[model samples]
Target: MTTRVIAVGGADAAAARLAACLGGTVCPLAQRRFPDGEHYLRVLGAVEGADVVLVAHLHPVDPLLVDIVFLADALRELGARQVGLVVPYLAYMRQDRRFQPGEAVTSVSFARLLSRSVDWLATVDPHLHRHAALSAIYSVPALAVPSAPAIARWIRAEVPDAVVVGPDEESGQWVDEVARLAGCPGITGRKLRHGDRSVEITWPALQPWRGRPAVLVDDIVSSGQTLVTALQGLGAQGLQAAACVVVHGLFEQDAAQRLQAAGASRLVVCNTLPQPGLPLIDVLGDLAEAAARLIAPRQG
Candidate 1:
């Protein structure tokens, strides 16, 4: 029972790395749009009777969702035995619940849509909130890969005399874990959001870490406003040097620039997504191991 790794658009490099790790072949998927704005997807290799792993990072969620559906259905139609997903950055996770009346739970709906196509799912550090785990919404066997160990290792190797800081209270757990692993002090700040791009961040007492480098860690940096606010607050506190570390760097538009402008000394992200300019820490080894386990038969 051989498993083949297929890379969807924008996921080619990570998929190739995963294929090498899994000792599987890389299958290419091509996409095109019709004149009226419909999508056409084609799997360029034979998948007949083979276990297939579709690697995609669900940023730019709408089009990628359609692509995954079309590709998975196509593979099944071509007689593929099992189809699994390796989504490094699982989107639609933020909308786990409705904030107002008459609103849809998009997370559950997205999970159902994905569950219909894949036998099992694997992703790196999904933005899980208001739910304990992926199993809450996704019926399929879902694995949430932790990038903390990897991030900690990167911090240890790169940042010296670093004090780990979480941008908001919600990130305290990850910050504490990473700091423990890196053998550094950890502190979390308070965040109040007014709108999509408006955020207020108040840092905790950093008297103990004054003059030491601050490493701000978080799961996702979508709009980067949170980080910008945090960095500005730190600078006002006389913390001159700061680094931003994240699992997913969905730096929308000039987000990276904004963070830099706000005085972030360095920006590092895991290779979960295709971050072209910033430094990337490899997470493919972890993802490949998870994918391999998903394809393996369970021992009862």
Candidate 2:
């Protein structure tokens, strides 16, 4: 079965790598911005009557989402049998629910929108806080492809003597998985949320990590506030680490510099966002491999 690869704007390098690995025809979609600030997307090649896999990663106000929906609808109209969405990093996931009055649960709404538009959905390390199962949250078949194993392999090769540490209790599960793969001990911090919904992070259990090369692991690093707080807390306890490893490196508002100033020796992340000052570990290979396995010819 022949597959056609369509990569929308973000993470072009990673997308290209995945397309090369899949041996699929790469169709580069051009993104243009109107003088009035609107967006334009153009599919460069023929997509009629083909199985199209749309690859893109969501950044702050990502234009890729708009393009994905358009591409999916166009492909279907042009005779596409199936449309597969492979988003390395899913945005608006943090707003999965609305606590206050009159707010949009962008995650669910976005999931529904994408579900109706495509046949299958795949993403990595989505900000799933309270969802018992992601499949239950989406009307379509949703899969969470973790980058922990890949991150672990890279950390093991680079920082051989590092311990995995979760910046907060929320990151415990991922830390455990990464620790297991990296063959290192792991620790999760205790967190206290204030009335303002601000967090007071503490790693009281990090006493044993005082002199070890520790690695802080998490799914997202938005403002770097959490990491800065964690690193300061670690310092207060005289706990020091080797580096930090994050899955989705948003690095908003100079978060990377903030983490460094807070004492992160090194920052390692997958090539999901085109942020500055970090190594781009290609995650598309893992994503494409998983997609290939999942969409493989159904056995009789």
Candidate 3:
């Protein structure tokens, strides 16, 4: 069975490229928003016995979810052999557990909803806190691919004289991995997060690496407070403005602008979600390999 790659929302180009990489065909998805903010979707083409991979980035979570859920069901009804999902940046992963009384563990709940829909799922650098892996919550075969290699390659090629810096101790392992892969020294700081917007971070021993520029690495940036805090600290020490590299650039509202104002010389994110005008580090190779692995069983 040939694999058919289809995109939801604005991922059409990425889907076509992925289809080309897999030596498959591109199946377009028809989507429209009704006056009342409801979703109207149609999966175009004839896939009587073809395997389909639906590519979607769950950034604007709610509405896109409606499209994904409906399209997945339609694929099954239309006689597709199997349906696979590639969610570049998954939403609702921040609250994996309940901290206080009567709170929803959205991460697990979202996982349940998706597990029932798609045959297999994959994402790039999911903010996996508490849960060991995606398989812990998802009933289907779920893969969480790493974007460290891509980030490292970018640093090596673009910023040759750089020392990787993680904003907090929680990110120590991740920072070290990227640093090791980039062939540079890495250091992680300690962070005391008061709330989502308010945070306090202790500087790592950045003085030793003062000669080289700093590259701030983060998995996902929403409010940009942590990175701003890190930047402020770096500025106080008279260090060069850091180059910010993130796996997922979930900069809400004017967060991206705010980050640039906060002394970020360059801001770059993985091609997980499209950020117009900003430079994107490609993770298409990683995504294609992970997606191919998911649909391999059906072809076999």
Candidate 4:
């Protein structure tokens, strides 16, 4: 029996690449939107008695979580023996804890729901803090894939004398990994928030980038607030703006436009999350390799 891979809809190019690497079939699934803005999804491929992998990114799409759950149930009903959930950008992971009294921890709740829906889960650069673990939250076989190699390769190809900047302390780990791979200098700046929801990112003084390019590396870009602020800060120091790289491109409405307006020269993000008209560097090769490693032992 051969393993099968399918994408639930959004961008098909990356999915097709991943399936090609995995020696799997890229089956079809259909989605119909009604007048009321409701989405109807149907899986058109036969997953019965097969090992199935569903590749999707939970970003800029309505009813993604609900749709994945539907597919899980439908696949089970169709006699699929195993299901792997590969969501490049996992949603609701920032809400892993309750911020205040009577607040619901949506991250853990979503994890629990996903755990029950699929047999194994894989995600890239999840916003997991100190209190949470991917496997612990999902209560299943979980894998955390980092985009350091991909981001590093992109930096080497694009930026000149780029200093990898981590906007906040939390991002230092990933920034360090990417910087090491790129053979570039890296720094983690101090960040403080006045309110529970806002932050100020401070950049350090760098002499090598006096007239050179610099890249900002981070896991997620939401609302483009932090990045815009960082770019402004970097420009204040007279450093030439190069590019911005992120794993999850959760750009809010006009976020890309706003960032470009705020003086960011180029924005680069992986196909993990679709960003229309942006410079997309696909990471399907990394993910396909990861899946191959995970399935190797099981297949043996």
lDDT for 153 in candidate 3 is 92
Candidate 3: 10-residue stretch with minimal lDDT: 203-212
TM-score of each: 0.96, 0.91, 0.96, 0.91
Clashes of each: 0, 0, 0, 0
Candidate 4's displacement at residue 176, Å, is 0.9
Segments of candidate 4 deviating more than 4 angstroms: 33-41, 194-198, 205-209
Number of colliding residue pairs in model 2? 0
**Per-residue lDDT for 2-37 in model 4, tens only?**
677878767576678778898888878898778997
Q: Write the per-residue lDDT of candidate 1 for residues 1-300, one digit (tens) a residue.
A: 767888886788888888898888898777889999999888888899788999887878798888889888999999898999999889988887889998889999999999998999999988887889999999999999989899899889988578899989888878999999999888899999999999898877778777888899999998999999988888778675558998899999999999988888899999888888889988889988998898886311
Which residue pairs in candidate 4 have backbone atoms (N, alpha carbon, C) closer than 3 angstroms, thus clashing? none
Q: Candidate 3 clashing pairs?
A: none
TM-score of 1: 0.96
Error of 3 at 259 (Å): 1.6
Two-way lDDT contest, 1 vs 4, winner = 1
lDDT of each: 0.87, 0.77, 0.87, 0.80
